[model samples]
Target: MAVAYVYGAESRDISAPYSIWKVVGSLLFIIAFIPLTLWLVKKFQLAQMKLSQSEIKVVSVQSLGTKEKLMLVEVEGERMLLGVTSQSINHLKSFSSNARTFATMMDEASSPETPSSTEEKKL
Candidate 1:
């Protein structure tokens, strides 16, 4: 009976430290897992963005009113101007292949035009 009681006490003492270690290891694993999972998700999202980079691009956007906007989008090398409202999106214009880019148009608008050589000769 005494040997049996000693065996039980020894087993309990051995298991107590191991059980505490197990709980601590589990808690540490959980703490590490959350950030690791978040990091992996962010990496995958970045990879997807890189893969779809050139498919469709938004060149510019303008807000007309509270719920209305104008969006210039480029898709497959074609540029389109779209008017967006709370209710619907309407296609305002489709640029031709030879049409100038938005930056060129802005520059031309901002710069003062000078008379040509022919105009000067005529004058």
Candidate 2:
């Protein structure tokens, strides 16, 4: 709008002609936004799909390199370690139901000790 105003002032034309380039650029952005928005929405949907009740979930991920990773995934209460690379994904190991997860260990470590429990143990 500023650029158009300056052009109009310089030309001394009351009805300043709109720049074709600006109109074309604006139209291009409008057209491009739809696909860009759709792509972003699709990517977000795929990311959110990783977790759901009664479905497979990625518990944790360890990146080895740009395209290599070790992922711990849970499916139907069974946890499995998978080695992922650019070529393919390989199953490393399977964990049983009684296995202690990293989350459980972290929770135990971070939890505060009760004063009553400590006094009882001392007694």
Candidate 3:
């Protein structure tokens, strides 16, 4: 029916109704276009963000309230405690990489239960 309609339209037959192929083609274009456009947008966004230059990495974030939170951020080799609110973000304190805070984090990452450790605990 759609092929017949298209053939009639191409032949300038005014009596023929609209083609189903036109509607299907439009739907297919929209489906393909949306995902392709979205992927391009995401690729563009990732390209714009320089991960290497972003030295301040968020180690952890804790919510205190609906609009207030605490964040532990590592800037260069130093770690800092941050107070975050809806209006602003403030640095509460800064500590060196050798600080107890960082040592504790390292200890947690390489705990006894981790598979890589060959040493067994003596009872």
At residue 88, candidate 1 shows an lDDT of 100
- Stretch of 10 with least lDDT, candidate 1: 110-119
- Which model is ahead, 1 or 2, in terms of lDDT? 1
Instruction: Show where candidate 2 strays beyond 4 Å.
Output: 1-17, 24-54, 103-123
Give the best candidate by TM-score: 2
* Predicted candidate 3 versus true structure: per-residue lDDT over 19-123, tens digit per residue: 666778899999999999999999888887755568778888889999999999898999999999999999899988777865687988777574434444432
lDDT accuracy of residue 33 in candidate 2? 100
Could you tell me the lDDT of residue 111 within candidate 1? 86
TM-score of 3: 0.46
lDDT of 2 at 15: 36
Q: Per-residue lDDT tens digits of candidate 2, residues 1-123? A: 999989878885533445666678899999999999999999998877755444777889999999999999988888999999999999999997579877896899879679888899999
Off by over 4 Å in 3: 1-18, 50-52, 61-69, 100-123
Ranking by TM-score: 2, 1, 3
Query: Candidate 1: which stretches are off by over 4 Å?
Result: 53-55, 58-123
Give the number of colliding residue pairs in candidate 2: 0
* Candidate 1 structure lDDT: 0.91
Q: Which 10-residue span in candidate 3 carries the lowest summed lDDT? A: 114-123
Q: List, in order, the clash count of every candidate structure.
A: 0, 0, 0
Error of 2 at 62 (Å): 1.6
Question: For model 1, how does the per-residue alpha-carbon lDDT over 1-123 read when each residue is reduced to its tens digit?
Answer: 999999999999999999999999999999999999999999999898888857688879999999999999988878899999999999999996569987898998878556785588788
lDDT of 3 at 34: 100
